[model samples]
Target: MKKIGIFLCLIFLWSNINASAITYPKITSQGAVLMDINNGKILFQKNGHGRYAPASTTKVMTALLALEKCKLDDNVIVGKNPPLEDGSKIFLTKGEVLTVDQLLYALLLHSANDAALALAEHISGSKEEFAHLMNERANQLGCKDTNFLNPNGLYESKHYTSAYDLAQIASNAMKSSKFREIVSTLSFDIAPTNNHPEIRHLHNENKLLYSQKYKYPNADGIKTGYTIKAKHTYIGSATRNGKTLVVVLLSGVKGYYKDA
Candidate 1:
């Protein structure tokens, strides 16, 4: 009876630990963080303060900066680069004029490196100048561990941030109506323009929008990231009973190990 009781106690403890860790993975990425949106308390953290390449997730700040510094009605000429990007893209032609709003949509949804560069250029006249703003703004916002070496987050030696820092920045970005609008949109309705359009369709890559298999009902707008090293990083959010939570997973690979 003693042995059986001990085994039962062990099982109960193990189950509790698993439950806590499920919502709190210790180091899924180089760093990971989960936060409560209501009061901004950190729910869980794993290497959340360690620096790692943020990859395309860098654009959340890029878009945030653009929305603050540039006017949507402003016409921006795509500077022969965004459409020529080698990675994920929506393909904007060189010299094509798009409103700052349109270019922003391109940057946010497509994660187009060129669109980021173009938006940077449009906002600060050059990517280098815009990068300066990114770092400064991050500091201003109290992201002590964050740095921005490029507007597009293309993995530079000097560019790095932790999942905690990412969450902080995301928490701020979430306050913006424009940012929320863009990320929540599963598909954007882009009208045709002279460059080419019969209503170009853009889809949000976030798979969670498709009725989460894990029973999260209020899941909504967020971002995903990966690189050769980063391996399927994701930032997710959802609302439950009027409470919101932000979950960050980094350095994650499927079928290898769960965050818990």
Candidate 2:
């Protein structure tokens, strides 16, 4: 009887432990993925490999290419007026000049379409040529499901990526100290340029970085996006107890922070 009681107690403890273990939460995003960057392990996923519009998250690859191709201090001249687009912007005028580093800050913090276009043109001579570099680098990074139609991620039929592919791209991007620094920035102030007299104050669009109610501790980085077709997209990374985790959410519901 004593031995049988001990065995029963052991079974109960085992059951309780299993019940208390961490479990994946149900997310409203059409596609999502959580990855452990330290060891390349996928923690959780929902339609992670399905192709979907990535929105402005495309800038991750754009920024990566800019970093690789241009020195941080290299001057990028906006020789021609940036293409007219109907989303977030820095309002750059023709002939405006800013360093590659400064433009990267604007690009990542504000999701500036103009900055994206300027960088693309400066680095590769035209948007078409820059997109080729983005694709080449993405392919090298093992992103089999990603294709870039433009630098700013303005919606295009051919512009699509999978959550799994983006996770890979983001994982590689985070390896750069400069990329991490730009994404982690909460707010930045850009001094007036020759073309614009007023100083530009840029704020990060990712609410997970600042919202007191939805704040995730140690949450840094990534990007956010929304279009009529791409409901709401977010890629986020946070470090806790020495481990860094990356999450990708595509076509998510309104409560983005919780879903992220």
Candidate 3:
């Protein structure tokens, strides 16, 4: 009986130690998910299927459709409406010509609202039509809780996505070699164009890729977003030891990167 009691105590202690070892940090974001990119396994989540405004993370869908429908070298002539877009921009003016490749770099690296509008207009003839395409693609990807009202992720009452849905969209976008290359780039230059004479140097806004304070090991391609309504949102990807993970956070108050 004494030996049996000692064995039972040892077993209980071992179980306690293992339970303590497997704990996960408290995630503060309202919506969050960590997924294995390769297998679509959801490793962790907090309200992963809860809907929230996605902000500029909508560009992942925009960029993916652009790559699918247009050639990189195809030229897109800026329209009157793109320059009129609200929020961040490269200030593309009417009749300014840039290839699909250049616009993608602007769209992803800089999160340029104007660039997203231009690509949408170029690919689908108008933002409304392009939004239709965005929804269609999201549906096909098995995302049941996403709706995109604009390619640029500007605030709209109905435009929203869950953390899981956004992760699915981002994982699909990362499959493209060009998409991967463009998002991973730290900075790029759009040479002097008909609309502007001086070279426009654009830097990536994703702090995880460049900012020392927020940088994560093995971090690479992905996107970030914010709006008064959305607050803060991010989709971050990193790879280590042959496995890649995609982390999504939406509607966080601040410091979402640290939570990631």
Instruction: Compare the candidates by lDDT and give the number of the best one.
Output: 3
Q: In candidate 3, list every pair of residues with a backbone clash.
A: none
Q: What stretches of model 1 exceed 4 Å from their correct place?
A: 1-27, 211-215, 255-260
TM-scores vs. true structure, each candidate? 0.83, 0.90, 0.91
CA lDDT of each prediction against the hidden true structure: 0.70, 0.82, 0.86
lDDT of 1 by residue, 57-176 (tens): 888889889888888888888786566666676677887777888777777776778878888888887778998999898998788888788877776777888888888778887888
Clashes of each: 4, 0, 0
Report the C-alpha displacement of residue 186, candidate 2, in angstroms.
0.9
Q: Model 2: how far is 239 from its true place, Å?
A: 0.5
- Tens digits of per-residue lDDT for model 2 on 18-112? 42344556778888887767777776788989999999999998898888889999988885746465588888888888889989998999999
Among the numbered candidates, top TM-score falls to: 3
| Ranking according to TM-score, highest score first | 3, 2, 1
